[model samples]
Target: KYQRAATCLTKDREALLAFYDFPADHWDHLRTSNPIESVFVTVRHRTVRTKGALSQKTARLMVYKLVQAAAKGWRRLKGANQLPMVTEGVKFTDGVIDAKNRAA
Candidate 1:
């Protein structure tokens, strides 16, 4: 089902297809990045709700506070009940922070 949907998007959505710059680098990770982009989208959405075009300072403040508050609970869940890291294919660094030192 996912393959069929991706094929359809590749054929139809020019905007979405432009995201596939390096097809080799973690396609599933790229898909996960999409939701992060929505945070910026939410900022744009709130910005346009103003009666006139927002002042630069005002826009920056709005985005800053929104992102800060959004990040509040984000970190707590990440390290909680964490599982062992799994690497795949050419990126099998076995959770090593410094890739150069790993037995690749």
Candidate 2:
């Protein structure tokens, strides 16, 4: 039963372990990251409560406003400053920049 799951994980081992290539400060965020789920939870609750009362357009508008409002209270990522380094192709190993691979 678990063999398939284990095989899938083994097949994608490199990608799964790629998390460690990010900044150590971001580990917690990476581990628990689910911004879409968190943001949509309120939307789902409110929409379900409304049942069929809302038109399709109204539902979209409400979801948009809800997400906009949620964005205001969202927490910023830790080690956000390292984002540029990462984007610039900086090499990280075990959550720290690899000095040997660093560009001058």
Candidate 3:
């Protein structure tokens, strides 16, 4: 079992390693499939309350507007200020940029 587990981990090493590529402050966001799913619960409930009487296009548009409105109330990501550095190919290790990779 240990040998099999080790083999699987080695084969999937790159994906496993990707988790550490983000800054530690954003790990809570990256680690989940959808961190904002909870926020969508309200949108979903509102849609369901419409009892499917609305046309498909209307329902979609309503949901889209709901999401857009909700977005205005959302908080910014942790360490979002560092996103530009990350986007510029900065290297992070354990969530912070490696000292060697930082600009002088």
For 4-70, candidate 2 gives per-residue lDDT tens digits of 9999999999999999988898898888758878888978887788775458898788889989988
TM-scores vs. true structure, each candidate = 0.39, 0.75, 0.76
lDDT value, residue 7 of candidate 3: 97
Question: Best by TM-score, which number?
Answer: 3
Which stretches in model 2 have alpha-carbon errors above 4 Å? Answer: 1-11, 101-103
Residue 91 in candidate 2, Cα distance off native in Å: 1.1
Tens digit of per-residue lDDT, candidate 1, span 21-51: 3232334454576557767777677767865
Error of 2 at 36 (Å): 2.5
Candidate 3 — worst ten consecutive residues by lDDT sum? 30-39
List ranges where model 1 is wrong by over 4 Å: 1-31, 52-54, 73-104
- Per model, state how many residue pairs clash: 0, 0, 1
